[model samples]
Target chain A: MIFDTQRAIAWINRIAELVRADVERLTTLDTAIGDGDHGANLDRGMTAAVDALAEKEPETPGKVLITAGRGLVSKTGGASGPLYGSGFRAAGKAMRDEGDVVALSDALEAMLRAIEELGGAHHEDKTMVDAFAPAVAAFQQAAGATADMHTAAVAAAEAAEAGLAATVPLQARKGRASYLGPRSVGHEDPGAASTVLIFRALADVTAE
Target chain B: MSSSANGGPTPPSVGIVLISHSAALARAAAEMAAALAGPEVTIRPAGGTDDGSMGTSIDLIGTAVREADSGGGVLVLMDMGSSVLTAKTLLEDLDDDDAPAVRLADAPFLEGAVAAAVLASTGADLQTVAESAEQAWSMRKL
Candidate 1:
């Protein structure tokens, strides 16, 4: 199933709902090694994204993502805001007018690239890249195998979840968590966990 | 202080923008730096998220940078983590022509802002102000 503009908006809104539901859990994950505001900040951003999308009702999938990104940047504070905003913005640019499986793969790849470029973080740094990188890879591989968007999204979501879990026991090398050094080894990265939710939302939407 | 050649109000040679996670913290730091820099320097506090929560805002920082600039340039002093990321992202978004000669100082937030502010108040150029701020990193308090 190819994702259109409406579908994309719905997916993002669904992610907002999921994020709102998991706010406390995400904040708990953050409190262990971070500033403990990840969930709240992201919830604010996602809520704003949904509202902005609903108000503008953009015509293309790309436009919807871009509007959502802008909303996040403006509404969400902290490093995550700019990082995630850049990712979504890049994905939107990469998607252009195409909503095929290949385009989705390219968009996810672009999102990862933007996050890395903006955040100066790489895979295994115990950042969102941990989840996003594997998700992008899985998406690209699945896109290569078939044209089914749902299949690729499922693969990506599963990879992201695994990556999120893998962040535990890894010492943070970037962000505020890095200040803890060895103390950060036992906690899952809040950013990576949130990334999993994003991919999962994508998969859920595509499956529906 | 020297007025403009045309007898108009003269702006400082450089401006300072303090980026912090807390709005009140940024404002207080800016005020402290302003006290040291005198009333000549344009010191703007671009802190917290848009809703006055704790976090850095790229839009707020960008706006503060523009507001602080008075033809000399702007110097950005960030607290840590996301503040630095947001400031750099804002710079990347600016067009070359509209983008001033802005520099993000890798110095201690309060000390750096104060040092940079004082330097700019003395009619120092943008580079000199930024260098002075960076010099604060080496200040030993032990």
Candidate 2:
């Protein structure tokens, strides 16, 4: 599937809707190991991003993602704002017109790089990187094998879900959850859960 | 006071940006720090989300860093988590030359802010302000 500007905007809008619907669930997950504000903060940012995209009417897929990212950076409070904002912005920069599976995979890789560089979190850190890194790898693998955006996105989302689940039983080594030490075990990382939601949104939009 | 190029008293040589999740907490800390640092130091509070809810704002911190800096460098003191991440992201976005030297101090928020402010007010440089804030970590409470 060719991911165009319209598709990017649709994906963002869908993400906003999904995040709003799952705010309580996400916040509950965060309350177990984080500051319990991830859902509300991300919801607020996504809402603003949708509004910004509607107002800006960006002409290109890259512009759409960049605008949405800017909105998130300005509207969302906390570390998630900058981390997610930079990720989206980096992906946008790497994306191309009528982007194919390779392009999509490259974009996800760029997003993961930006997040990793900014957060300094690695795999098994029980942070968003846990999900994001694996999702990027899954996208690359699926794209290399099938050269299909839908297949790549679905694979990425599935990998992200597994990564998110894996966060449980691992002690957090970054962010507020790290302060809890062993107490953080058994609680899924809020950032990782949110990363899963983002990949799921990507998969859903591409499947449509 | 040292003379500026314009022949007026030189502004303080360093500034402070206090970042926190709670707007009230940041503001109160800035106020307390100001009491010790006097009126000359530039100490800006960038706290809470844009809508005044709990959480740190990157836009707010970016603006605070720009405003607090008066050619002198800015030292950022963060509470935890997102605050530090947000500040680091903001720094990365800025151009190296266009942006003033900004340092993130690893210290307790309240103590660091107060200590940094006092140092800045004395016309200390950016490194000195940041080092003073870090020195707060060694302060023993007993």
Each candidate: how many clashes? 0, 0
Tens digits of per-residue lDDT for model 2, A97-150: 767777777877888999999889888999999999999999899889988888
Cα shift from native, residue B76, model 1 (Å): 1.1
The segments of candidate 2 whose C-alpha lies over 4 angstroms from its true place after superposition are B1-12, B96-100
DockQ of each: 0.74, 0.77
In order, the first chain's TM-score in every candidate is: 0.98, 0.97
Residue A22, model 2: lDDT of: 88
What is the alpha-carbon lDDT for the whole of candidate 1? Answer: 0.89
The global Cα lDDT (0 to 1) of model 2 is 0.88
Tens-place lDDT per residue, model 1, A1-208, is: 6678988898899889889999999999999999999999999999989999988799999988888988888788867888988888888988856688888788889989999998888778999999999998998888898878888889999999999999998999998899999999988999999998999899989986
TM-score of each: 0.94, 0.93
